[model samples]
Target: MAKDKKGTKKADSSASARMSNKDYLRELRRLHVEIVKLQEWVKNKGIKICIVFEGRDGAGKGGTIKALTERVSPRIFRVVALPAPTDREKSQMYVQRYLPHLPAAGEVVIFDRSWYNRAGVERVMGFCTQEQVVGFLKAIPLVERAIVESGVILLKYWLEVSPQEQTRRLEARIKDGRKIWKLTAMDLKSYSRWYDYSRARDDMFKATDTGHAPWLVADSNDKRRARLNIITDLLSRISYEEVPREKVKLPKRQAPGGYREPNYPLKRIAEKF
Candidate 1:
């Protein structure tokens, strides 16, 4: 495998190639089944799993997460996408707000974006001081080590998207009503500082990517392939079996027993569709 300038293996073009809708759905169905099995095993065995996703704007993190979690129980597979820090949170320890949201027993908590904000957006966007960034970079590995030692299976992912693809996605967001909200002023600012973000990401990888909790980078140029690849990689990292289950049988419903329908006039909205 040829290595990129970053010393990581260049992704095989064919491997990360886009999938047809039919093939994407077919594979997704299979993965959804496996995800359900993993969910059951985690619940049955009281396992704790935490997944953190980090990436540049328009890198498909949200889409990847949506695919990864859409088929699972929200109670079991919780997604935490916290808003900007409150004043109190800003005053408190940087990691304090995030700590409370870590996975409990029998839970698979996923952070759409996580504590590494200080290293990436916060640093590049001047939301935090260089000293604060330095401190966070230094302390995070130890914090992660503690989280691992405490029996939480932590998996971190960094979605790597090409600059051209990112531009396309962001531009689409401008013209698409559904995605316009995703393209914020901050996103525009961040887009301008592409190389700045790259530097920050490189530093983050160098500092926090550790043996206990390594950062897994995924090529996200093809949104469909990225989602499938990420979900597959996630399942691979965790050891789970299909928890045993009894065959399900639908029970017969009882007769209405002369329950007459009420004649009240209910104002129902017109079914335009």
Candidate 2:
């Protein structure tokens, strides 16, 4: 063991430099496997659940969703990513559309951004009337309390990024050929009202944060860290009796078919490029 001049112990200094996203992807895949296992574990318990993800633009909310649901059974896991309300949707009661997307027994529903748009974007941008904004703020805690009382697991995540990071990521998206379209009118609103949005976001946390449904803040400055952190936090929230590893029944093999000889031996191709 060695010590620095200041008497700090030099501990485990041989590790590799910061890992690439590839490492993070592998870890996320492993966590997704656990989430699938959790669904079966919670099945008999009938624990309906929702994990709502919200954040500034370019905070990797969609990427986090990919990691969370990649291994979960599609039939049991649902993701909702809707656009701005249409004329038809605007006519209906606001919460009505979201009702159809809620989780069923043993199911998990992930909302890319749930109903909180009212408290954040709609408020800052004046999209919602002040009265409507107030209404959403007042109803949030009450509605969440009722949902929690119903034995549903509600985990909310707020993926936050520093303003500088936001600008960098947004600019990078513009330069990145594939992501230019991500800089949309709505996102432009967010960046323009960065301070206003921050205040509005704080209001959101204060208004809806309760013992029943608390906001899990995800430091989203780094995409890989955010993905890994969010998935692990969600898994910690759920409790299941046991996953039905034994219940996975494999079909019996067909009666031993007569062996057929291969027409050719396996061959390796050599590349000389």
Best by lDDT: 1
**lDDT per model vs. reference:** 0.94, 0.82
Give one digit per residue, the lDDT tens place, for model 2 in 1-273: 568999987764422333477898788778867776787876667779988999888888988898777776777778988788999999998777887888888788899998888888888889889899878888888888887787778999999988877898899988999988878877887788888988888888888888999999998877788788888888887765554455668898887588787788778799898
Report the C-alpha lDDT of model 1 over 22-105, residue by residue, as the tens digit: 999999999999999999999999999999999999999999988988989999999999999999999998999999999999
Model 2 ranges with Cα > 4 A deviation: 1-19, 247-273
Residue pairs in clash, model 2: none
Query: Residue 150 of model 2: what lDDT?
Result: 78
Best by TM-score: 1
Q: Could you tell me which residue pairs clash in candidate 1?
A: none
